[model samples]
Target: MSAAPKHDVFQAVADPTRRQLLSLLAESDELTVSALSAPFAMSRTAVSKHLRVLSEAGLVRERKAGRETRYRLEAEPLQELRRWLDYYERFWTNRLSVLRQLVESDDADEDVLEPRGPRAVD
Candidate 1:
């Protein structure tokens, strides 16, 4: 057996393929590796590898039934990502509010706020 992967939710979801798999898993309670592989051109083994990464990151849960293994999304780990994004959302909201105030206020500096494009030398 290979060593367990040390991956965080952010790292696991970095790959587009893994992100797709998460979406697929999220839509349903559980799906086999084959079902997840159907959307992509890669082999089932490739999908399995992605699933393993998600499992390692605690983003997914797996259970075996007969000869097949089913994978499901574990959305709890996503809370961390949500919290991180929430922080930035508030940050940008504050920044945009200040910008709005600047735009509406008469005391604003037009020269500093004006957008400049590249100009040719005279």
Candidate 2:
């Protein structure tokens, strides 16, 4: 059987350029390729390539306006990423809480076992 296409939200956002593109799109309703390329040192073509990756990941939507092709952020796909990260966030929070309790208990035990009086000379 043929393998399914491998494009995914994680892979799409993995590149710094693509992440910047997403950030730019998020800040505005839509932006043209030229507008998106303004703040970057890369060429417009490079910016478009990043946009294409976002498009494949369903993290961006494109629309034609007159002579310009405008791109907009599509945030629905990010819900999956957020949910996945939130699960790990809770997991780490629980682990840290347990660790804190253990450390506090150990400190209390150490205090109880420590000698309070000065030692006598032999």
TM-score, every prediction: 0.88, 0.82
Leading candidate by TM-score: 1
Query: What is candidate 1's lDDT per residue for 16-89, written digit by digit as tens?
Result: 99999999998999999988999999999888999989999999999999999999999999998899999999
Please tell me which predicted candidate would have the highest lDDT against the true structure: 1
> lDDT by residue for model 2 over 1-122, one digit each (tens)?
95542568989878998998999999999999999999999999988888988998889999999999999999999998899899999999999998688667845677555678998889
- What is the model-wide C-alpha lDDT for candidate 1? 0.92
Please provide the root mean square deviation of candidate 2 (C-alpha atoms, Å). Answer: 6.8
Which pairs of residues clash in candidate 1, taking residues 3 or more apart in a chain or in different chains?
Answer: none
Clash number for candidate 2: 0
Against the unseen true structure, what C-alpha lDDT does each candidate score?
A: 0.92, 0.89
Candidate 1 weakest lDDT stretch, 10 residues: 111-120
Number of colliding residue pairs in each model: 0, 0
